[model samples]
Target: MIVTRFAPSPNGPLHLGHAYAAVVAHDLAYERGGAFRLRIEDIDGARSRPEFVEEFFQDLEWLGLSWDGEAAFQSHRLARYAGAGERLKAMGLLYPCRCTRAEIAAAATEIGPDGPIYPGTCRHRAVAPEGAAWRLDVTAAMNRTGPLEWLDEGAGPQAATPQIFGDVVLLRKDLPASYHLAATLDDAADGITLVTRGMDLFRSSHVHRLLQALLDLPVPVWHHHGLLVEPDGRKLAKRRGSPSLADRRRAGEGGLAIADALRAQRFPAGISLSQALNGTP
Candidate 1:
């Protein structure tokens, strides 16, 4: 059976972009007689709030979407993340890094998919500094895994090219796992067969594919759907202060109406769907 999930971080209330992504995942699974699941990505202890989590549940319920089981929380699976990191460390695929973001930015020469590609400053450090984050040795990992590929529902077969991101972080100094590690593990754990998310995250699938190869996790097909963007084409993000679903709900707007409009590709004025690849966006 196909399984899909809507994994959202509870750092803020759900926005229209999140609503669209959730609806896509929910519909894909339900229409095919599969299971839809929810996963709360609350691993960032400092930012994640219980009130926001409750609000997420309320928003999804208000949006007329339901999951098959109780939602999974990343906070409850810290040990599993730590264990995965340890396994990677044992394989000599992870290295500790102490470079701060500002330092990396100053030293970075080339830009990669997720911003400045991290320069391997601490890649060869013999001793790990205090509060060092763990980074995967992408070069060595690729050497071990050899050539890899993953399938996308829309793009079809894609050759995994994780090297583009340089050495990506697997475990953070402040958190047990980064999104790359936790999400890959959680998807496999939840038995997800299809990963439905926005196209903005399309490049992330390459890293996730490499992680699966290293961890021996089950591979799943991905669907990188169009992103909900502003009139200027900037993707709707909580950091930029996009309007939340809770706000609409509190205004006496009908949830089903909003969902139906979204399903029909009828977005609010100034909001449009962008299906183009990274460059065009």
Candidate 2:
């Protein structure tokens, strides 16, 4: 059966961008007679809030996005991430890295898609496992997997280039697993067939495809859709104080009405889905 997921972190309120993403994933599965799953990415214990999680469910319910089966939470899947990380370690692809962000920024020279890439200084260090950040050796893994590729439903066939993100983190000191590790593992666990997400994460798909190969997991087709943006051409983000779905709800907006408006490509004043968007995924 085809499956898709709308995974969100419960660190803040769901904004218009989030609503668009949820609608896309939910509609893709529901319209195709597939399954739509909702997963909570709450690995960051320090930042994740219980109230936010409650609000997330409320917002999704208000948006008319019904998910299949029970919801999955990253906190409940730490052992799975740990097991995968250990397997990568056994393969000699996972290594301990104690480099702080500042230290890495100082050492890094080239800028990749996600800020300055790690300088790989800790790759040779004999760092301990406990309370240490673990990184994946993308180059070493690529050498093992040879040339790899995956399909993007929107962009068609493409080669997987994991080199853009050098030595990506698998596990952080404060968390059992990083976003990369948790997401890759849980998708396989839930049997998600189509990874529906925004195009901003297109580069992330390259790293994820490589992780799938190195971990011996099933690869899924990705649909990297366009992003919703504000009138200023800026992407809606929680950190930027974008209006939350809850805020609109408090103002007495109807859920289905908003969903209909979005379907028509209409957004709140001065906001719109990126003009680069084509047909629905």
Candidate 3:
């Protein structure tokens, strides 16, 4: 059976982009007669809040999206994340780095989808200072990128290779689990056979796949939906006033209105990606 998930970080309110993602995943699972799981990615305890997480459920319900079983929270699964990280470390694919955020920013050049790309400043030099974060040895990870292709429902085929994404951090100085580590490990633990999220996260899938290879986990098919852009073309985020479901209901904009607004937006029908590959679109 195909299993997919909609994991949202509970640091902020759910927005239209989140609704689009949730609805898409829910629809796919419904069509395939599979399972859709909801996971609260609240690993960042400092910023994550119960109120925001509570809002997540309300928002999804308002948008008419439903999932099976009890929702999973990353914060409560540290032991599982640690075990996965330790497995990578045992394979000689992890190292500790004491570089500060400022130091990393000063050395970075390429800007990744997330932010300032890691300069691999600590890869060669092991200055083993106090307060260091653990990093996965991407050089070792590169060897594990086996031949795999994901038939993304929206993004079409995504081919994996070594040069796609460089060495990535599996854990941070202040945080025990980085996004890649927690997400990949949890994806396996949940038995997710499909991953549906935004295209912004699509690039990170390569690194996630590499981690799965190292840990001998099953790779899930992916579907990177188009982002919900604002009227000015900027991608919508929680920071902006993208009316949360609670706010909408308080303002008398019921679930039907929210659903209509989301459904009206032009989303991928899986034709464009195929067209682009065929040099048509």
Candidate 4:
């Protein structure tokens, strides 16, 4: 059976962009007569609030999204993430780097949409100083492609020859698990067969796939959908607080109304809320 998951961080309220992602995952699972999973990516514990986490469930339910099995929270699975990091370390795929944001900025050469493009400075460094951050030694990996390859459902497979983020951070100075680590672990643990999310995360797939290869985790199929841009042609952010499911609930709108509104806003043909959830065609 095909399995997919909707993993969202509880750093803020769920906006239209989130709804689009959740709906896509839910609908894909239903269409394949498979399972949908939900995961709370609360790795950034300092910024993830309990209120935001609670609101996430409320919003997903209000928007008619459901999942199989228990909900997984990243904060509670630090050990698992740490284990993966250790495995990567054992493979000589990682090393400690004591570079702060300012320090990295100073060394940064190519900047792109995803912030600083990592320059491989710590690749062959024998030892790192104390209080250093952990980084993936991309070059040490057996298949370190300067550019990576990934498969997307809607757009098919594609490859980028240049590195997206150079020697990206896998672990912080305080040893907190970063999104890349936790997300990769959760995807493998959940046995997810497919991944569907916004195109904004399209680049992250290369890193994730590389990790999968390093750690021998299954690389799920991905579909990077377009975002629900606002009238001004701007994508929604957590701070914007668009007409979320919670807001609609307060306005006395039911699930169907919310679904209709979403569909009216350029949803693909023949896709209904029911189809999105249960695939009852």
Q: Candidate 3 lDDT, tens digit per residue, 89-158? A: 7777788787776877788887655566677877865454677778776766775654755566665676
Segments of candidate 3 deviating more than 4 angstroms: 109-111, 125-128, 144-148, 162-164, 264-281
Off by over 4 Å in 1: 277-281
The TM-score values for the models, in the order shown, are 0.97, 0.94, 0.86, 0.86
List, in order, the clash count of every candidate structure.
0, 0, 1, 3
Which one is best on TM-score? 1
Could you give the C-alpha RMSD of every candidate to the true structure, in order shown?
1.4, 2.6, 4.4, 5.8
Better of 1 and 3 by TM-score: 1
Error of 1 at 222 (Å): 0.3
- Cα lDDT of candidate 2 equals 0.85
Q: Model 4, stretches more than 4 Å misplaced?
A: 142-149, 160-162, 264-281
Best by lDDT: 1
Candidate 1 or 4, higher TM-score?
A: 1
Candidates ranked by TM-score:
1, 2, 3, 4
In terms of TM-score, how similar is model 3 to the real structure? 0.86
lDDT of 4 by residue, 53-137 (tens): 7888877788878889889888888898878888878877788776667766788988854677666667667887787778887
List the candidates ranked by lDDT, beginning with the highest.
Answer: 1, 2, 3, 4
User: Lowest-lDDT window of 10 residues in candidate 3?
Assistant: 272-281
